[model samples]
Target: MKKWCDNAALLTLHGNTVGMVSKEFVVSAPGKIILHGEHAVVYGKLAVAAALSLRTTLHIKTIHDKDDVLLHLPDIGVEVGWSVPEIAAAVALPVCDPEKPAPPSEELLQKLKTFASIPHDSADTKTLALVSFLYLYCAIVGSQKTLTPLEIRIESKLPVSAGLGSSAAYSVCLAASLLLHKNLISASGKWSEKDLQLINAWAFQAEKVIHGKPSGIDNSVSTYGHAVSFTKGSEPVILSQVPSIRILLVNTKVPRSTKTLVESVKKKYDKSTVVMSAVMDTMEAVAKECLILFEKMYKGKADEYYKQLEELIYINQQQLDIIGVSHIALEKVIQITKANGLCSKLTGAGGGGCAFALIRPDVPKETLDCVIQQLSLEGFDCWETGIGAEGVTLHV
Candidate 1:
């Protein structure tokens, strides 16, 4: 077995005059994108997801005084404070056991919704985000020990509501920071695998607060980091090593409802069960083949694997269109990539949110530039981002 823990020092004394050095904690997690699965994964199909280079970070600093705990969330424009005693009073609100955190009670959810001034049935980004943070803070800090005045700030480079797993990154960072603050994990050393698993579990609970029935892929990948292959009813298989690839992620700027797209897929499957099942079966094969290729894609015979993966992307995109999740915005992205002799597909539940293009090593700079320019001209946000990045990490 390999050891994962590394020791980090805390509490440095600078002055001979003896001033207090505040304990500062920094934890960060990377976002994710589905590589070969979209709507098909909903009905028990294989999906491969990899970590994004983009990350969200949380900083926690303990103040010496007894002021309220302050939270600064500049990404979502939330800055608020609550006294430790005030949070303690929230004990009356139902909190599940930390070992097994269930969904927060409806009463608590409604209360939080009312407090955040968000309407019923639809949890706004800010509202759900705040509720999850508060719940985690209280459920962890409020339960174990007396709270101290601290300041927590969160920031992210990933675009929110663009299906890049922004929320999962945020939750993973939060869980790691709070756990370290509570001394549940080592602050300054490589984290043990057990420590990381605990972090992932707690973070998943936070996700539950935001999304009623999350697939757990986002938080799991954010916590574990790397390329993972997952199918419902099976544990996610994280590759020991993965190939790094550059992808052109384009945001169509067309807002679509995931639930609506899912329903549309359901309707299609219901209409042609036999044909759709065969499509799903083919998708499963593509994903499995890609998983094997990804293990050694960077090594030998790279061009062969790249071509096969591109074909898979094309087929998957066609299946997405057949299931009725494709949008005109997504089609335009595909067209732009095709014009440049590149391959692309919508990465998540589509109808128009985001599409990603593969930038193979053989792609000419002029073609890449032309494609990016064309996508940008059409009011799409494009980023050349890395895949298979590191997971949540701790800093002292």
Candidate 2:
């Protein structure tokens, strides 16, 4: 791989020094869009997800004699650091210091300690996701001499908090970078199924820091970098070997909290068995349809495959609407897209995140443009993305 030199050594942004670099690794994780299973995935139903082109990259470099780790989050203007030993100790320590206000548990403290070791006084724009990665790095690789107070730089192509699983991509990239730094995965070799599983496991564990209770789809897709049939609390089932198909990711700047959405689902689930069962059934059907569509398309029947997929997409959106997760922006996009007979649906945890529109090959450019214009008029942020592009990769 070619090295990308930013020429930062000659131009220090804030008096931060660059040391003799031992090695640097670059890793990427794919962004994701959910077709259905917003609240249903938690109950053991399948969700159809595709990997988006947007990704997050982590640049990890080792430095000499620098007890201080530096994090240069240029995208978020965060530069901070802490001593290596101190951070490890912090993670090992319990939160309750007895003298302090309820010390953190030994496990939780250990994770926080590793996070504080990040090279920055304040967390960056992607701090939560980075912290999750740090915890995983310390756990799997151990805080040995091989890992030291280092500088990490992050760049993300995905929009943060836009329902594109940006945090998942960040965590997955961080885990991949740390593992590569430890030489767990060969730089030039292909990763085996076991290697992918290990990476996914580590990434999922790390995701806890960003999301209190992640369903694993975000990390799984980001780690595997392909469309898969993901069921909560179950192993991911790879949908195809050919990778995901192309789609449009329309982001609604309106932010939605995953915790809130999850809680909402839980509340409704406990209140109405009928509603919950219906939502889960819809999700299961959507998942099956997506799988069938993939199979049909793989067999060289593109038109029929798209037709089925579009119908499924519409049905999935209707389910989301029934579940009260769909936002006005997402619904508007769906209406506009469907008005032109296009396939579109909410992609992630609804309630104002992002949506996806499956485009037919024969659809006229004018129709697509009209759909986009209508969405734009409704204040939706939309863009085209290739599916199943690439999973996590290291850059040196």
85-114 per-residue lDDT for model 1 (tens digits): 766565553355454555667887776566
- TM-score: model 2 vs. ground truth: 0.80
How high is the lDDT of residue 317 in model 1?
A: 87
Please estimate how well model 1 matches the true structure, expressed as its whole-model Cα lDDT: 0.79
Prediction RMSDs, each to the true structure: 6.0, 7.1
The global C-alpha lDDT for each of the candidates, from Candidate 1 onward, is 0.79, 0.67
Steric clash pairs (candidate 1): 6-189, 6-190, 8-188
**Cα lDDT of model 2 by residue, 291-389, tens digit:** 776776767756767777777777877777777788877777777887997778777678888888877778788988887888888887778777866
Query: How many Å off is the CA of 265 in candidate 1?
Result: 1.3
For each candidate in turn, the TM-score is 0.89, 0.80
How much lDDT does candidate 2 score?
Answer: 0.67
